[model samples]
Target: MLNKSYQQRLEHDLEGWVKNGWVDRQNTGAILADAARGSSSTKIPAIIGILGAILLAAGVVLFVSANWQEISKLTRLLLLLAAMWFTFVVTVWLKRTSHDYLLEAILFLGAAIFGANIILIAQLYHIDNHYPDGLLFWAVGTLLITLFLRSRATLVLAFCLIVSWASIEILEFAQHPFWPFLPVWLIAAGLAYWLSFRFAIHLAFLSFMAWFFSSIDLLIKWSGFSDSETGGLIVLFLLTSFIYGLVMERKNSPLSLGFGDALAHYAISGLLLIVFFFQVETIEFDGWPATLPFVILAGFAAVLVLGTFIARSQKIFNLTDTALFLGFSTWFILSWFIPALNHLWLQAAIYLGLTIWLLIFGQKQYDKLLVILALIAFGCQVFYLYMETLGTLLDTSVFFLLGGVLLISLALGLEMLRRYLERTRDPQDSRSQEVAS
Candidate 1:
């Protein structure tokens, strides 16, 4: 779907094209009208249909709950089968009728019902075994339906089920369960790219990130690294994400899997957010032997800094990009020695500074995503500060007063800068287009 701003820009450009005799006004209007009609299918009807599906599924669950004890074992099994078949049949009918929104809704409902059936069936039969098996069943069933219907919505649901299943196994086993997850995740990624399911692609990336972090953490623990050493794993994760992002951007990765450098973008953003949350506390080590992880941390930091510089020289890394990587590395490396930097106040100050710098850099680059990330970081810092406040009247008053003033100033400055950039970029863009034409 087109972003609202982009949609507006398209309309504005279409009007200009109409005026310039580059396109017929009536034809442009018809094209826009067609797009509007197509988009409407995914709006109200889709919402209402999804809500209806959820309600219907809830009602089924309620019925099952009410009659579960009275029903025989076979009857219970038959009931679940009937529900699945009924939902599938309705989905097919909706598809045939070109009720695309309702079809998607029914598919989602079917997945929910299928998962419920997996758990309920196991429970009713007293065949309760490992709990995650239910999730595996749900994942497989959902994925089959996704493949059959070629539904992006169902694909997302299936991927979530798959990820959840893997996470459960990891937690339950207290180790990385790479056996099923690795192959399953690869299959999910392949399907996401093949179907061009953008949300599914993102889910796949997130699932991989979780798996990667968990695997690294498990490996570190197994290798006799103390819990204090896990920060090194995160540093490594961040470095790998940056390097991968540089590679992906350099390759000009295909859009079939959706946005380019999606893994890197998510990994970097997620790792930073995680660090903000947990970096306030320092984990102490016992002796010099425990300091081994810090050596690894330093190595990763150096690699990140060196790789970023190389990327910059190759034009893959912009100034803002280099600064971001180095900034994160600097903060992490400092935490290794100046344990006091993990103090709440210092962390808040660093986050605040980082957010402000991001705002300025994002404006310079005209990067809306980075600007949004900066805003989110600012919000996070504000929330963290509020949580950390001493709650004394004077401190509370001062905190609110300063925070309110700073936020207002930041908002106004960002707005003015964005407007200025928009105005300046438009003229340059138009001139470039004219020259190209």
Candidate 2:
């Protein structure tokens, strides 16, 4: 389902289209009415139903916990099985009755309870091989149910459980070449795509990124890849994904359905994250393999350049897009060569500048997702700069005071700059419109 805000905006646009004669009044009204119906339907009731189900599920668990010792082991086990069966039975009835919202809630609660059941059973049998093993079972079971019921809520839960189990196994147990999650993630990702669940796809992408970053260094060390090779591989992966997204965007591929917007964001974020690692590469300063980071920088520049040409060819290129590309590429490349950029203040400045660019671009394009990304980047940089610079200073209170003042000053300066840009750009925009007219 589309977000309420988006649906409302779409309805507004439809009404405008009617006035413009792009759509007939009758058709426009019909579409808007349908959108209103969709937007209003399922949201409030689903939310309330889901919340109630969660509370009821929790109550059941608490009740079980209170009487856990009173019941025999067999009885306890039987009760858990009964709960699982009962949930499924209720799910079937809900499906039969076409109560999809309540079904979703019940399915989610059932999946959660199933996880609890796994742990309980593990404890009952005194099975101890690693706690993640039980989680793995739980993930599989949840995924199976998710597939059977085609439930987005359960799909997300399955991904979370599986990703958590995989991360724990890899990080804590020194599990090498964690190949299992690749297939699991692929399956989950495929399912998400099939279901057109953008949120689930985002979670899957996040899970994949977590796995990649957590295991990349270890994978490189184990495979005897040098820093340059490791960097090259990472750069290649980022470029490939970005190019694939661009290709999909150009072609309007069905495969990109439900996630075209996210693909570009992921690509941009991957580049930004790579830039961040280079921004903090002090530990290995001795043998700093600048090759890969530089390659990534070059790749981004090339993409920006290529994209400019493509956009121009399509008559879609604009000043804002040019500025967005140049801003990020320049910041990324300059951060590498400028020794002064190593300072936390300078790093924060660069990040803040990028954040501002993203915000401006988002505003110009009316892309809410881009605005959200900008806010996230701003918050992250603020937190990082604070953490990195705060403890090193001798007088903590003074440091904080200075930091707060600096931030306030920067905010004011940025606002002034934004106003100046808007003022300057508006006249040029009006002139261009006059010329086009």
lDDT of 2 by residue, 1-437 (tens): 45778877887898888786669877866786677776756478887878887787687666555656767889888888888888889999998998877888888889878876776776677778888888888888888887888988789888988888898988888896798889888888888888889889889888988888888877777766555445544545554465456556666778887475677678767765775666666523223335654565466557656765565464443665565655555555444444554676666567676776667656765768768888887777766666766766665456558767876896798689889999999999889878977
lDDT of 1 by residue, 1-437 (tens): 45456568779999999997789987987877766666644578787987887788788777666656777878887888888888889988988898887788889888888876876776776676888878888888888887777877678877888888888888876547356788878877878888887777788887887887778755665677765466555656665665566565666667524355566567557756766766555567433325667677667767776767777786766786678757766776456445566776667767777677666765664667767888888887777677767566577668668867987998898799779989999999899889989
Q: After TM-score superposition, what is the CA distance of residue 396 in candidate 1 from its true location, in Å?
A: 15
Model 1, backbone clash pairs (residues 3+ apart or across chains), number = 0
Q: What's the distance in Å from true for residue 421, model 2? A: 18
Worst 10 residues of 1 by lDDT: 280-289
Q: What is the lDDT of residue 43 in candidate 2?
A: 77
Off by over 4 Å in 1: 1-31, 34-47, 68-76, 86-101, 109-113, 116-120, 163-190, 206-220, 226-229, 239-252, 261-265, 274-279, 285-331, 337-353, 376-437
- Evaluate all candidate structures by whole-model CA lDDT and list the values in order: 0.73, 0.72
Error of 2 at 413 (Å): 20
